[model samples]
Target chain A: MFNIFKLAARNLRRYKRRTLLTSILITLGVVAVLLFVSVSGSFKAMMIGQITDSMLGHLQVHSRGYLSSIDSLPLHLNMKGEQVVRVKEILDGNDAVEAYSMRIRLGAMFSNFTETTNVRLNAVDPEQEMQTVPMLADRIIKGKKEGLLAKGEILVPELIARGMKVKIGDTIVLVATNKHGSVNGQPFVVRGILEGISGPGGRDGFIHTDDALALLRIEGREISEIAIRLNEMEQMHEVFDELKGQLESSRNKMDKPVFEVHTWEELSPFFNIARMIDLMTLFIKIMLVAIVLVSIMNVMVMAVYERINEIGTIAAIGTGPGKILSLFVAEGFLLGLFGTLIGVVISLITIAGMNAAQISFDFGRQKGLLLSPTIASGEVIVIAGIVIAIAVLGSLQPAWKAAGMDPITALRHV
Target chain B: MTLVTAKGLEKTYIAGDITVRAIRGVDFTIEPASFVCFIGPSGSGKSTLLNMIGCLDPPTSGFLEVAGKDVTHLGAKESARFRGDHIGFIFQDFNLIPVLTVFENIEYPLQMVQNWPALKRKQRVNELLEAVAMKDQGGKFPNQISGGQKQRVAVARALVTNASLVLADEPTANLDTETANRIISLMKQMRDEFGTTFIFSTHDHRVVKSAEKIFTLEDGKLQQQGNGDNHV
Candidate 1:
């Protein structure tokens, strides 16, 4: 068997140009698909990272009814007191949850005591929210990112600051209605100017949890939701599943589901765009298969055609039909093997070169999105296997024809 | 012993609506370890007779035997096995496998057909290379050798498996007269050494001159059989 494969290998050396061209065709296909899968996969992953790591915090825990009317900022539907502690127990008990932060999101009117505009406001625990979304501080263009807003202080978005003529250290008043439907107002100092975000609901204001509770006249321990960050994005669903099972399993003192769980993919609308990129990668792979199938099959047929006399000679020398078939099939398999091997080596170099080159693109509010092509070992193995399998499939017809040839006729084929 | 026996052998071809008779009923017998030649003009069924005798093609309507085994009805696989075991073929064009070196081509038949052990195969190939005076050219490819040298390699390849009957179809048609005579002399020596019977389908009189016995065919019919240029 080894001798046959070696013999088959030498056959390629007989037609250097044909073998090289065919190998190049298959190599191009493998390289193209591998690189496309890796680079597009990286782009998709990076975009999801922007939403999950920087904005959405991977998973969110909130009341089932809150997300439905979250646009209305219904303060009455927030998690509070013992229920918050219960959710914390569920979260803290699980190792997948790296961190969780509580936020009280509300709609409020922002004014310089003269010019007034509606703004979405999030009242957050300074330390926890800052840790959960570290990029938020990174986007603070005009103030220190080390600490969150202090009591009687707020972080104003540049959009609103420029519109209302507010700057760092300026005093501003926020007026809002509480869960009781009563109106209230409070004075606060602008501690920082945040760079404006790009997606929906990106322009917002951040204030201390105590300031929000005081302004809303809430003496109780009610909050909007718990935002969770996990250690790894690849394991996002596994963590989400574990979190879901524990929270949904909470049969209250009476058998009622208290909290709903969601991964960033569910909560962020930008996730749909990421899914489309993955689907595009799938299409590119199919295209590679077509290119390899056509080229490899084409080359095998020509091989059989050119070697008709050799086939006849071997047959007359008592080589069985099965051996003849195997001979041609081995040729195709070798073609795929060499092509895939070269393609993978070249693709690895290409990917490393790409990373070293540090190609960049701007997507939404994020700049310099790195184009890193990442391939798992399993993916390379599978790609090489598929290309070789296709090579064999493409050779089947021609090999069969070669094996079925009548020696007398083939001997005369010139 | 009778190494080949054929009685009423026939072959026909269908071309569109017409049936062409390539060979009419023919009868002949050859003895073991003899150098025999079948000589005739073109279309005289010389190759057709050799093809039938070598198990390359089945007889259309007759009983034929080679090495005392009936080959008139052998199937494709069985015929190939039988040919590998008992028959060797030398084509006019010296049909050597171009990819293989001279030694590899000679060793190929043993590997593919007889399943000879490597040491035995190597021994036989080396002996034939010595016998053919191609010992030093074993590493060269067929294209690297001269026409006569290529024919010598083909002869070595054919006999490497130790077939009982070696069939040479117009083996000397491509060489010059002197080269053809030399190749015929080489075959006579191989027969003396290996004691393998040889049958030739040839148009050249030089090959006939070297044969101990010659059969002449005309229009697919046996016209003469003689020993040492004497026919009844």
Candidate 2:
């Protein structure tokens, strides 16, 4: 076996130019794949972080029919106070739950004295909401990041703030209709202006939960939704499953399930874009496979064709068919190994250089967000394994043809 | 005892609708350590007979034995193993692996086929290199060496495994007359030193003159068999 490998290496060296060219082709393919994966992976991670950490959290719990009518912020479908307490108990007891914020979602009329417009609002406990969505404070492009909001003060969306000419310290009136046929209004000062996110929740305003209760004249501690954060985002599905299993069994007096659980993927439109990035990454990988397959196969076939007489001599002198096959395959395997090694080294250096350069770009209203591209070691291993395997697969046909050659005919092949 | 025996040996190749008989029924025996030559014109069954006798090809119909084993109907793999264990081959082109140095080419049979140990294989290759007077050319690749030197390396390679029988098909076809005679003499000397049977096919009268026994083939049939001068 060692002799076979030695011979195979020498054979590759015999055609130095061809071997180098094929190796370069494979190396470029590998570098392209690794770099694309790292950059696109960074983009996806940043996008998800913006949506989840600033708005949705990792997952959320809502009243059974609430999400279907979530666009309208239906007040009658809010989880009653008892259901909130039950859900709170489940969240508190689960180790995976990092923090959760209970919100009162409502539609209101906003007027900055001269201008009036419809605004969607989320009333939250400032401390809990901060803990669940830590980046929420970072989204405040103007005004206070510290307290988020105080009672009788609101954080207006940037679009609304711009349109209504509302600013920090500007007093605004919010009018709302309760579950009953009653209307109420409250005046509040703007504490901050939020940078708008890209999707559905981008235009919503924020206020203190106490102010929402007072404005709506709610009799009990009913809440519209619970936004949950987990210690590890990768475990979102497991935690969602565990929590949903428990919550799904909890019924109202009418014997119907009371809540629905959703991951941030389901709640955000940005996820489709994330999936498209993933699909593009897959297509890049397929392209890498095709590149390796064609290049290695072409080189191996040529090697066999050019060395037919040598193959015949060896076969006639007692080298077996299996040995011939392995010799060619080993050459291909070495090609892949060398190319992958070079490509991985170059890719890592390129990624490091990107980080050192501190590349930054904007997504939606988030600006100067630095892009830090990274690849997991497992991903590198998998990609390298795929290239080497494909190289071997590509060499099979040519190697088999060499192995099956009749020495008499091969010697006369010229 | 005979190293090779063939009774009514024949070979036929079929291509599309054509059936070509390259070797007609013929019988022969070769004694161990003997120098034998087959002299024939083109398409006179010289290479076909040698291929069958070397176990590189199985006869279509015959009773054939080499070193006491019937090889007329051996399977492809078994035939390859048989060839590896019992025979060595040298080609007219001095078909050395171009990538390998002369020493490595000579060591190939032992290393690839017989699974010889490194030290022993090195010793055997060195001995053959010395015997073939290519001791100084061990590190030169085929193209880097002269045709005579390359043929010398081929001779060394064929004897490296101590094979009981060595087959050469037109071993001197590419060499000058003097070089051809020298290669033939070296092959005979190796046969004497290793006690190995050497069977070769050639159109060179000089090569046939040095052979102890010669068989003449005409139209796929052995027309005559005798001592070198008598047969000619």
Candidate 3:
């Protein structure tokens, strides 16, 4: 059986020109798929990491309607005092949850004596917010990044500060409308200036939750949402399930979930763009499979055609059909193996070149991101396995023809 | 003992709606270790009869047995197994696997059918390579060798399996007279040593002259059976 494989390998070398051409196609297809998958995979990881670590966190648990009507910044949709305690207790109990931050999101007007601007403000606990969004405080350009704002103080984004002519330690008025339609105002010192983000929720201001409560007529304890950070991104689904079960089990029967859970992908439209990259990569791989299948099949069929007399001779010499099939199929298999091995080597060199090139593209609030193409050993194994299997499958028809041939008739074929 | 017995064999096939009768009503008995030849001109079904005796193609209507087993009606797989177990074939073109070295071509049958142990297979192939005068040429591929050397490798390959019957279909057709005569002599010497029955289908008079028993065929039917002049 093993000797049959040796003969098949030798046969490939015998038809050097034909084998080389088919193998080049296989090598090209494998290399294209490997490079594309690696580059796209790295790009996805980077973009998702940027979005999650910068603002969204790994996942978010918000009071129902808060995320859906997040644009309207409805204070009435905020989680109630006891509801906040229940959510916090559930989050604290989950091992997957690395950190959680509570926030009161509100629509506010910022003014520095003369001019005013509408701003979406996140009234956050400074310490927890910084921990949940690891890069949030790093975006602050002035004053302190860690201890962002004190009572009666606000953190204004640089764009907003420049527009309103406000600076760190400058006094500003925080004006808000309560749930009762009552307008209220308070004074705050600007503690830090944050860099303006570039996406949908980019232009925002930050203040202490106490300042937010002081500005708004809130009856009891409440927060707009809780953004959660998990130890690992893969833990999102398990944690979301456990957290949702904990929250729902405590609720009355037949009542809807008090909160809607969203993974980072759900929080922004940007993740979908990342997913589109994967879809495009998959389509390209499918094309590679098609090319390999057609090219190898065509070559093997021609091989069988040219070797009709040889086939008959072997059959006449008492080589059975199964061995005959193995003979030809081994040809295809060796073709794939050689090509894939070469392709992998070539892909590694090409990917190294690409990474060294340090290609960059602007994505959301991030710019000049380094492009890193990474191929996991497992991915190379799986893709190579598929290509080789397809190559063998492509050879089955021609091999079968040779195996089932009538020895006398086949010998008579030209 | 009869190594092969064929009685009232008939073969026919459809070709574009016109049925071509390739063999009709043939009967014969062959003894073990005999050097025999079936002589005929073009389209005489000499090759067809050899195919039937070799178990390559089934007879349409006949009782044909080879190596003490009924083989006329064996299916494709069974027939192939039967051929592998009981027969060796030599073609007019030599038909050596081009990719293999001469030794590898001779070893092909042992590996494919006999599952011979590697050392023993090497021994047998080496012995037969020596027997066919290809001992020094075993390292070379068929294309790298001369036509005579290629045919010599083919002969060694045939005898490697120690099959019950060795069938040669116009074995001398592709060779010049000197090479053809040398090949025939080598085959006869091998037969005298191994006692493997050798059958030939040929129009070549050189092969016919060497046969101990000769059957003449014309138009898919046996025309005569006669003893060779030498009868050795």
Could you tell me every candidate's TM-score relative to the true structure? 0.90, 0.97, 0.95
**Which DockQ-derived CAPRI band holds candidate 1?**
medium
Instruction: Say what the interface RMSD of candidate 3 is.
Output: 0.9
Of 2 and 3, the candidate ahead on TM-score is: 2
Candidate 1 structure, TM-score to reference: 0.90
| Candidate 3 backbone collisions, by pair | none
Q: Per-residue lDDT tens digits of candidate 3, residues A168-264?
A: 8899887899888999999989899887664545567888888888889776898888889999888788887777777765553557777778887
| Model 1 Cα lDDT, one tens digit per residue, B159-229 | 88888899999999899988888899898888888889999988777888778899989989988888545
Query: Candidate 2, residues A1-414: lDDT per residue as tens digits?
Result: 787778888889888999999999999999999999999999999889988899999999999999999988999999998899999999999999999999999999999989899999999999999999999999998998997888999999999999999989999999999999699999999999998888768779999999999999998799999999999999999999999999989987999889999999999999999999999999999999999999999999999999999889889988899999999999989888888999999999999999999999987677788999999999999999999999999999999999999998899988
Candidate 1 Cα outliers beyond 4 Å, as residue runs? A80-86, A149-151, A196-201, A242-258, B5-12, B21-28, B60-62, B112-120, B218-224
Error of 1 at B15 (Å): 4.6
Q: Which candidate, 1 or 2, has the higher TM-score?
A: 2
B102-197: candidate 3 lDDT, tens digit per residue:
998999888878798989999999999989987788889888998888888888888888887899988998999999999999899889889999
lDDT tens digits by residue: candidate 2, B68-142: 899988987898898888898888998998888999999988889989999999898999999999999898888
Chain A TM per candidate, in order of listing = 0.91, 0.96, 0.92
Each model's number of backbone clashes?
Answer: 0, 0, 0
Sorting all predicted structures by DockQ, with the top scorer first, yields 3, 2, 1
- C-alpha-based local distance difference test score of model 3: 0.85
The digit string of per-residue lDDT tens for model 1 on A1-414 reads 666787889998899999999999999999999998888878877666655655668789987678888789899888879888888888788777788889899999999988999989889987888767767786677776778678898989888898899988889899999989899999999889887655544677899999889988988788887888877767888887887887887655667777888877777777788788778877887887888789888998999999999899999989989889888889999999999999999999999999999898887766776788788889999999999999888888999999999998899898
